[model samples]
Target: MNSEAAIRAAQNQWKHRGAQRPAFALPTQPGQESVWDYPRPPALLSDTRTVQVRAKGNTAPIANSVRALRVLETAAPPTWYIPKQDIDMQRLVELKGQSSFCEWKGAATYWAISNASAQPVAWSYEKPRSEFAALQGHICFYPSRVECYVNDERVRPQPSEFYGGWVTDEVIGPFKGDPGTSHW
Candidate 1:
């Protein structure tokens, strides 16, 4: 199959399209959101809650903002994307030749804290697909790699290294990236 056809086929493999929650999904309490209820293809929503990111062992935050954009997708915790202006650009260095692609978001460029570990702690889409054009000039961090907080609550990293969803008390899940959830 051609590339476009292959992409479509792969995208179609997701069994839960988010129109309804799966049987195994945990019940959401009041003031909580179930990841299962988020839509497929994802939805980008503006968030005004304070979001913060700090490198490990650092007392100062690398990024903090109330103007974050959240990408919510089926069975995944929301990944908060902070505008470039809210981040400390001087402390970040682009990792050349390191990149990844998302079927929905297009290419991603990785970034790491300058003078710290070489491991990438964050990533951004410089030229996202039209559907996600708003994500340009925004960056998202891996909670596992850095300290991340949303509305003063610390975030837990999504279970897989390949996924960067941020988990907090407000979002409940049998989230994607956990063992045996690959088919979702």
Candidate 2:
């Protein structure tokens, strides 16, 4: 099968038999309805428009890692979503960065990674508003771009994927590549 077909079939197999999906904007009570319920809120929630990101630990060898440095979280291996203002602007080296658009978010600008003691790691977004700006200060790493370091030890990411949060240890499922896997 073609890659797209294979992916579709693989996705179909992941459906759960018992899962309660949340209703998008159903009424919680007789009178509750707002952005809280799909009602609405002020256009802007916060006055702060910018956030920053920094590389934790010593993961500066790979470009993807630096790109992942855009992640913002109080915890480590934060998802890379660094806002333009949150990043250390002086250290960044904006190459002929590429751009892409997400259906939910807006345009994304990629940056060539740069570090003080090592080579570049990855790219990041600068102005990512539209709800996702909350992802500001966070970074998402390219599995293909960097040498992942978990607790000071280099850890190889699972193959056939691109995005990852270097720190989240949540076990997803008996995914496609999981052991004892069968044909799609």
Candidate 3:
């Protein structure tokens, strides 16, 4: 089967197996934080880390930013919001045909992985506001898809299946059927 076929098959399987409109009970946001809004990476993240882009012959070096934004963590992986300045923008090619709709964030633009050696990676963002302007050109990576490194040591993605705060270390829970996950 072709890549698109494989993707469609997988998506179909997931849709069939997943709960029909799971409830999305987002965790309570901390004081000063909006209700399950985007999260920012810790202030201590290093810019000199040895990041890897798992695309098709390219392992582009990346500048780690202290500014990753977390959108959500599901029964899958933690979603990170990266800043465009922290990434090697040359590898992100805007995709004309891919798009995703989000009620809160708005319409997202899609970008495909362009590196030959890096594994295929595609990213999208619903329309983001000025508060999220840092993420305008940046793309977040799925810990399941991309492996990050700090110097020679590998940095692990957050462990929660239902949370996406880049600065927090606790991986919350098996929140599959939580309140508003139907659209996820």
Per-candidate TM equals: 0.96, 0.40, 0.48
TM-score ranking, best first: 1, 3, 2
Lowest summed lDDT across 10 adjacent residues in model 2 is found at 33-42
Please name the candidate that would achieve the greatest lDDT relative to the true structure.
1
Worst 10 residues of 1 by lDDT: 1-10
- Residues 1-184 of candidate 3: C-alpha lDDT, one tens digit per residue: 3245553553444322223223443344343232222222111121332434344233655436656554542343334556677777786667676665433343567555564433324464545543344445656664434555433444454444333222322333333334654433
- Best-matching candidate per TM-score: 1
Model 3 whole-model lDDT (C-alpha atoms) = 0.44
Cα lDDT tens digits for candidate 1, 1-184:
3277776886788899789998999999999999999998999999999999998888799999999999999999999999999999999999999998887888899999999888999999999988999999999999999999998899999999989999999999899897899887
Worst 10 residues of 3 by lDDT: 37-46
Question: Could you tell me how far off, in angstroms, the CA of residue 135 lies in candidate 3 after the best superposition?
Answer: 3.9
Report lDDT per candidate: 0.92, 0.36, 0.44
- For candidate 1, report its TM-score: 0.96
Report the CA-based lDDT of candidate 2 relative to the real structure.
Answer: 0.36
